[model samples]
Target: MGIRATAVACLALVTMGCASAERTPVTSTAERFLSAAGEGRGGQACLLLAPEAARSLDDCEKQIVSVGLRAGAVRGVDVWGDEARVRVDGDTLFLHRFPDGWRVRAAGCEPRAEQPYECEVKT
Candidate 1:
């Protein structure tokens, strides 16, 4: 292969690697948040929420669990800058990267027809 072609291929590989690395943490955070919420560990789940999102809840611990979140197999993860969307078997979650790490911005979201998602929990 030409030198230019080789450099392009390497650049593409590096980009793909970066995307995959970002996705891992996003997916992990989403799954952990869902698991905590689903298992009635509301306090744990609340800790994974963004500050605004957590505060949006009248009672973070109780309401977080009562939302009926389910942890299904993660089907897709899309990360853009510090924002991410995770799609599981029956749910979609949105997250934002914070100084500490990724935190849930919205959960229990359902896509609407040509509109933004409708979320049960959001900030």
Candidate 2:
């Protein structure tokens, strides 16, 4: 798959997807992540990321804080099972529900024509 497709594929799986109450927590996680990043709290932001997504970067803590991520008004949310897509005023985020709570798997994402969202951070 193309690099962009990776982000969407993770959201495309659903044999029995439905509107979920998990939206609130999921959106909160994404908001907190962006808030931390925008505030230069790299460690805190990294704490909210999925493990693999965190490890995907050579220097996750440093890179995550510098990616220009920002918290904005939440525009929409779509949740399916453990996965979620949250649209903010200026960004798109993907998240997963871990055993502890919801964590971001991708952030600072944007869609291309027919391609998956191109994410600034992803696993």
Candidate 3:
């Protein structure tokens, strides 16, 4: 391959690697959020939430801790573009990718009847 062609191929490989890397951070963010909430570290949990999600609550620090969230083994993770959903035991979490990293947009979510998952905290 020509120099330009080789450079493009290398760039493509690098981009692919970066794309897959998102999975780790996304899963970790969700897990950390749940762990913090479960452990009664409200401040740490709030830090993992999206800015809008955090602001949506009148008392994020107090309310987030009392939402009955729990940390369990991650059952599954689906990442598409800037959005991600993680399933942890009985709870489902939705996250949004931000400039800095992924942040939880919703947590303590449960299935509903033909509707969006009902969430205890959402943006």
Candidate 4:
């Protein structure tokens, strides 16, 4: 193959490798966010959010950190198409599976229409 063709082929291979969800892909990127939050890296955690969720709040990372919610593990993931809900430490999180990946819509949450994010974290 020509140099240009070879380079393109190599690029494709690299992309495929980087996009390796071949074996046991994460249930959702929300899990990664929780891991990040648990480690107290709000900015990194905030990066994995659903667009609407991202837009719904201001100063996303700092706001999360302010809530004294470092992070929690996703005990379960219930995915139905683009939307998914996760359970963590008795609290639940809402997420959306975007074209790119999953993002958190709400955290420290429960399925309560009246008070979704009422599971306050200790400061």
Q: Which scores greater on lDDT, model 1 or model 2?
A: 1
The segments of candidate 3 whose C-alpha lies over 4 angstroms from its true place after superposition are: 1-20
User: Which structure among the candidates has the greatest lDDT?
Assistant: 1
Candidate 4's clash total is 2
Candidate 4 lDDT, 1-123, residue by residue in tens: 999999999999986675444211334565677777767787887787666665655776776666655446557766666666668675677766667766677777656676635543211
lDDT tens string, model 1, 25-82?
9999999999999999999999999999999999999999999999999999999999
Task: Indicate whether candidate 1 or candidate 4 has the larger lDDT.
Answer: 1
Name the regions of candidate 1 deviating beyond 4 angstroms. Answer: none
Note the residue pairs that clash in candidate 1: none
Model 2 lDDT on a 0 to 1 scale: 0.89
- Regions of model 2 farther than 4 Å from truth: 1-20
* Clashing pairs in model 2, backbone N/Cα/C closer than 3 A: none
TM-score of each: 0.97, 0.82, 0.83, 0.62
For 7-104, candidate 2 gives per-residue lDDT tens digits of: 67766644224244467688789889999999999999999999999999788879998899999999999888888999998899999999999999
Candidate 4 off by > 4 Å: 1-28, 113-123
Model 4 CA RMSD to the hidden true structure, in angstroms: 10.0
Candidate 1 lDDT for residue 67? 92
True-vs-predicted CA distance for residue 41, candidate 1, Å: 0.4
Q: Rank order by lDDT, top first?
A: 1, 3, 2, 4
Per-residue lDDT for 72 in model 4? 62
Worst 10-residue lDDT window, candidate 3: 15-24
